[model samples]
Target: MTTPQTPILEARALTRSFGNVRALDGADFDIYPGEVVALIGDNGAGKSTMVKALSGSLALDSGEILFNGSPVDLDSPTAAADLGIETVFQDLALAPHLNAAQNMFLGREKPAKGILGRLGFMDAPTMRKESQAALDMLGATVRSLTDPVGAMSGGQQQAIAIARAVAWAKGVVFLDEPTAALGVVQTRNVLDTIRRVADNGVAVVFISHSMPHVMEVADRVQVLRMGKRVATLEAKKTSMEELVGAMTGATVGATS
Candidate 1:
């Protein structure tokens, strides 16, 4: 549970708004390479808003974002992607008709010559090879990359989505409620995948309200309340009751 040698992503005093909503007021956060930091909060606590700002899907009304300890302007999702930031939102966006390989290589196909460009060129062998490697990295047991993702189990589909991001992106990865809808075994699969990603030197931001899940997988935990970062602690040093109390602003609980 030690912090990384360097922070891959850091947000200092990050503030944003939608008209008078006043979402994410002076929120400060940082994610280190090879670490998974759980982000937890109650409803309307601005968790999604903070994630959007970091993903560059939404801009900060004020404050700053740092990539590799340097200031950065991630104006759009594409901009963030270019800097190796990938988001695995709950809606995976996989084409139900497309097979795992197709979904994994969606939009960012490797360029080659000939009809590969005409209509829709695909280097099938190469794409499948890459997809297989990514899946194997996380121990995904898929019968074939030719199988439609929709035909896969809830856990396998979730693995594919995370693998897709890992295959292409080399920087920070954000999991927005990744395990919310997974069954017990499936949830374990996703949690294992997250550890694998972090072990591979990619920083992971896991946004979840499930305190027990957070306790299980997070190296550290950040509690957000009223759109601000209220507390952060090493996972083992903090108890679930402490986390709950911190999020709820309950006194006579959390250790100082």
Candidate 2:
């Protein structure tokens, strides 16, 4: 894939600290339009911290965030969402009792038209239709829209979470461990959905420790170690050994 000249989202010299631990020490990252960039590292290497900072769920001690080439302050998750940036955390965070459509429109439920709307009646049909459209767009399959998300398979639930994020996100979507704890088929389906999302022109920042999955789906791999970015390599050109070396600090250079 040919990389775009400018990034849709970028971080420069980001730093964050938690008491004695420096979670992010001068970290840098960038993702271009319609690209799937994987962020990988060992535990405590600041992968989570870097994601949190970029998603506007955590504030940094010092750094700069550029959206569409202009500096922007991501003070909260709402701020990030308003800017068309969405994150599907590892937890999935679905309402167990709620159906797929209901869960998708949990906090942003649409009201019915006329007096029923004023009386606090939700537009369930519209929400359900849109939810189906979103899932179809991402090539994600759910057994039924009315079925409770908790009753669905892990992969189905994951698809719903991702589709919800992609439905609202116009520029970038950050997915954390999206294919974790799944069967081989489920993992493959999720990865295919990820590629479809990028095909629709959304930049996907995939965070995963699974090297094989990363190599299969990512166009570029960004490695972080000791709270800083150590290497950025093209997935097609780099091997798993090189990625592991970068994560373990055995290699210390950016190939991309």
Candidate 3:
């Protein structure tokens, strides 16, 4: 029998509110290493709020977040990044004018050696080499690493963005609407890359509205309704109708 793995990240009774609007109401989530979990819900279901809280982009009113089974405060985005957690929002967040390699090492640029390093000169060659390796690992194709990212196709740009996050992430990655507006080929490339990332032993929390894509890539589906997790189901064992029912509260009593 296979042993049950402990969750790499866990959220227990997480609660957040904006005035009278409760964004997260005793919500719960967990993800194991090397697993892909899809977080799904309709509008006002608190998917975005959950992502923000877990990514350390938003503060929680009450509840706890655990990393590797130990309580950890995700006080800020930097704090989450320090814990090897990364989030890729829908916008992609790439600098349009920068090349693939440049964007990958943007804020965390490799410095040059000797006095040049102290003088704030970047180590271009090393950054490019590492960036190329990361992209290659994800099987993401970019026509030119030297060319500006803005000139690349939508799929190519998405690939670069994901590769950058995967390169730096050590534990978990949260991707929000990653395949939203891409063409068929581009979406396929991104979905394939997501699988590769999980295969490499990092937990992936994929937030998407596309049931077909979610069912295609996720090992499990987590359904949220009215700011709480109502059900967690095995993707292969559950159908779209079941997932939609859970999201809409039509299917009750499903939990964890």
lDDT of 3 at 57: 89
lDDT scores in order: 0.83, 0.90, 0.89
The candidate maximizing lDDT is 2
Q: Report the C-alpha lDDT of model 2 over 59-173, residue by residue, as the tens digit.
A: 9999999999999999998899888899999888899899999988987999999999999999999999999998887677899999899999888898899889889888999
Extract clashing residue pairs from model 3: none
Clashing pairs in 2: none
Comparing 1 and 3 on TM-score, the stronger one: 3
| Residue range 1-256, candidate 3, lDDT tens digits | 1214678999999999999999899999999988999999999999999998888989899999999999999989899999999988777889999999999988788999999999999898999999999888766778999999999987788888888888888899998998876777768877888888888888999999999999999998999899999999989889999999998888853577
Per-residue lDDT, model 1, residue 147, is 84
lDDT of 1 by residue, 41-101 (tens): 8998889898889998887889999999899999998899999999888787678888999
**Candidate 3: regions farther than 4 A off:** 1-5, 147-153
Ranking by TM-score: 2, 3, 1
Which scores greater on lDDT, model 1 or model 2? 2
Best by TM-score: 2
